[model samples]
Target: MTLNHFDDQFEDSPQAHDAERAEDLFVLLSCYLDGEVTPEERKQAERLLACDSEARQIYQQLSCISSGVQLMPVAENPVSAEETTAKVFARMRQQRQRRLAWGGTAIAAMFVAAVSGLSPHLGPNNQQFAHTPAPVSEDIGNLAPSETEPRSEQPLNREDITSRALFIE
Candidate 1:
């Protein structure tokens, strides 16, 4: 069947949006095998594997790769968690330093502008802020009920509310 037919089936189902999300996560089945997937992603992958033959085949392929990796001998130079964290922090520090270097130039430029009296209010071309007026339309003007219309001054009772109830309407 075409995607349109599948879409029609989804439109008929209450869980249509959920099914679409699950289908989107089908590619993440490999991530599920790696323990890198979120709980929602795992659920979607499982649902897809249970129903889709193509997904099942891809899952089997990914499982084989995982099993193959497990069969290999442990690495002699296995990096510790602390070492990984340190390297990540080092990289972050380098990025922060680069950002600060660029930010310093901007700060210097702003200081020069302030010292040279080129600030917004001090500039010769400075203009007062203006408020734009809202557009006037007949539709908007007619929306409010006129004082000429007769309005019921009576307070609504339980019977009136029950007779013309919220959801019943």
Candidate 2:
């Protein structure tokens, strides 16, 4: 109850020193109960429990406390195991759907942004963009053989190709 009450346990001994020894003995007894002591330490604990009635009483009290803890009521879950599993799976599916939707939207946004950003640069000043290639037709036989030397540095226009290409029959 008080320091003086514990102090009266040992005659002519300092209270702090005796208190520390009592705590050490109690911890040793607890470790022995939990089967955590080494073989040498176990022998020491067994000797202490055999010789001291106080150590034996403390060990018995600790055993009762431990067994009482095991007997305490366990909290019950409100949901059934099946319902919990179904809810977890449903959440995973929802998250997957959201990710897929976000990924597809991000790809489409990037494509639109890229096309819009480059459109202004694709004018007559940009020679690569200015020259529009002739559209391919499924009727391959109606196509004309390329007349200009493919290696020629000269630029040809639609006017230049009038003699060879897509003549109205």
lDDT of each: 0.79, 0.81
Error of 1 at 83 (Å): 14
Cα lDDT tens digits for candidate 1, 5-119: 9879878886886566556555598788788889988898789889988788778887898899899999899999999999999999999999999999999998988866766
State in Å the error of residue 42, model 1. 1.8
For model 1, state the Cα shift of residue 147 in Å.
99
Name model 2 segments beyond 4 Å from true: 1-13, 78-169
Candidate 1 weakest ten by summed lDDT: 160-169
Candidate 2 per-residue C-alpha lDDT over 1-169 given as tens digits, one digit per residue, 9 for 90 to 100: 7898766755456876777778988999899889999999899999988899878888899999989999999778678899999999999999999999999999999998878767755533444323444565688865675666365677787665864465422
